[model samples]
Target: MALSLCLPLLAVLLQPAASLYNCSSQYERTPDNSDIIVECGTHTITLEINLCTAQWAGFNASNLALNGNHNNTQCQGSVDDSVDPPIIRYQLPVNNSQDNPCRQSLQIVDEAPDPSGPFSSFSSIQSVIITGYVDTPRSDVGLISYSTDLYYHFSCRYPLEYLINNTEIVASSVSVATSENNGTFIDTLKMGVYNDSDHIYPLVVPSTGLELRTRIFVEVKAVNLTGNFHLLLDHCFATPTPYNMSQSEQHNFFTGCSVEDRTTMTNNGLSTVARFNFEAFRFVQHRDRAKSSIYLHCILRLCEPTNCQVLLSSCNARRKRSLSPFGEETNDSATVSVGPLYTAREDVPNAAAYSNNVAPGKDDVDVAGLVVGMVFGSAAAALLVLGGWFVLKKYYWVGGRSQAFE
Candidate 1:
């Protein structure tokens, strides 16, 4: 009886330990008689078997699936091709969701030639799943549409982090147009972002003095804004001819020629649209020139509503005076004023005379005529004053003699 009890104890000790995981597998055959099998468990793996040679190719960690309701996090994965039948390993965080995590589905395509001979053809596609525990957070904003008059349009959705209530979003665009052939020709304009797609303008060609203007528009929408929020645009300026030359040379060539504007929006939600306008001018010498293109770089930002006011005040306080083409001093605020280049006249005496008359340069004839008129008028006034004084003296003398006789 003691011997029997010892035998039972030995059997219990010799029994194998329980497995940490279990695996499930499925298989399918290709038309060419190759077998493709997919297996899933704690680790997903796939295998392709050649029926003729009994050889096999395999892949591990091919796809991953994650639970839908998991905390937002970013995960990284890398492919190890150095090993036979390459594998992709995902480094998931330890705190990721255990049940129903997000997953990656992989499609494996076999394009390898048949080992039997070149005369035979065989191909197959197999899909495998590997569970992962990562979550992608929803974006706070989306870029609906961005269109150009040149018929180029780009639109997409991008995530905005740290978005909060009662905040402001601002977009400032500064586009500089530079000549591709020569570095001298350039023009830049800035304005409050807008969505007016019908505005057609001109950009000046520095070489030929021709106008060539292109407008830029920007629209912004708040994904899910709440409370008292605002959308503002500020501090937008463009350097049209930012030539590759020295700073002084560029300043002299441009001569403070620029356009600027500011706009604000107080509405809530995605209805708030802020549009920006920019006109670019590049100088190309050839009249029937080859195709030329303009490059524009812009920046868009978001901040608190109170921050917008502070920025606006700072910009205003730093304002400087700029000279216009007409030699008049104007306020260099973030505003643009468009006006006629020259005054029109009904009569034309002669080509040269009309040109001289309308020219902005000072005229010697006008200065001489004004001076002569002033001298003659002054002499005539002096003579009239002397005559009036003589008449008064005679009347006074006669009256004095009469008083003496009395």
Candidate 2:
């Protein structure tokens, strides 16, 4: 009986030495299998078999770093192998003003690819917005033209289609001689979510996850001699085809995606400064669904002066690859007065002409106050100098007449 009790205690002690911490090591168990084993000195313990099978079954990270070891990351690649055509839309700056080509600029608000919430999708048409301001009464203004290259991060798995027979990634090209033209282009790359039955799509790693950035170059020019023209630009997320766009839906997808100039020319030619403030949102309908709209609360109004020179003429243009998670603000208003105008010494310069056509009686009080202050300051300074000179004369002269004062 004592021997049996000692045997049980010895077994317990041996068990701990054989499998104390229960940790495993990576070791090949078979031709297609692996095993994790634990060892303590001469004792061997089988901890687990095929432990990482589940993780590698899907695109999973070996660890949290997503190093492609487990093949868990979605593939990153282009949407197609060819370039799509360009689309252009125009809104004149002023009614009845001579039409000019509209200018455009593209700004990428997000680099993450596809399913940018409900407000974004996987189409080249979904990536650009067209917005501009109208010139007022005097309509001679420049034609606005916009062109940009879409920069993308290439995934070995899902390479984007190129422009010329799969030779490049430039989308369609467009040019408008004037802003009166209108056209539409829509192309979709059925990402994992929007894939149609036509093409064999590959698994794509999210472009955002890779932290890629894209930009569009835009230019706005003065085509004519119009100076009082104010130009603004904005964008709307392209409506997904086969998807009905409602009034609310239109408002939803374009959330916070507008920009405008912040100053204007008043009737008197003085520039009225403007401020641009905006907000953006991700509008949803089905809560978990991947389709929604973006909305931009855009107001292009005048603001207070920010600098000495008033706003003459302002224009804003932007092109972005990513949807605006939040819209942008631009201070494009310029000084319109052509020359300096004087209203009782107040230099009121015209932003457009820089000429002085001062309004009478407006700045007279200020000028008079300035003059009074200057006169008082000059008198005080003169008195001080005179007093100092007299004191110096007395101190240097010993005998009033000062002939060496001996």
Looking at candidate 2, the ten consecutive residues that score lowest on lDDT are: 334-343
What TM-score number comes out for model 2? 0.16
Taken over the whole model, the C-alpha lDDT of each candidate is 0.29, 0.25
Cα lDDT tens digits, model 1, 298-389, are 22222235644553444334434232211111111111212111111122344444455664335667778899999999999999999999
With candidate 1 superimposed using the best TM-score fit, by how many Å does residue 388's alpha carbon deviate from the native? 51
Candidate 2 residues 1-406, lDDT tens each? 9999999998886664333222233311221222111111101111122223212221111222111112322211112112121111112222122332322222212233334322233232111222222111222355652322111111011111111110011222233112122211111110011111221332122322111111111111122212332222223222211222133343322222322222111121123221222122223342343322221221111112231113223212323632342212221111110101001111235544223555545567668999999999999999999999999988877556666555
Off by over 4 Å in 1: 1-85, 88-235, 242-274, 278-297, 302-406
Model 1 is weakest, by summed lDDT over 10 consecutive residues, at 149-158
Candidate 2 local distance difference test against the native: 0.25
- Alpha carbon deviation, residue 322, candidate 2 (Å): 31
Clashes of each: 29, 94
Q: Whose TM-score is greatest here?
A: 1
List residue ranges in candidate 2 displaced over 4 A: 1-174, 177-228, 232-248, 252-279, 290-406
Cand. 1 Cα-lDDT:
0.29
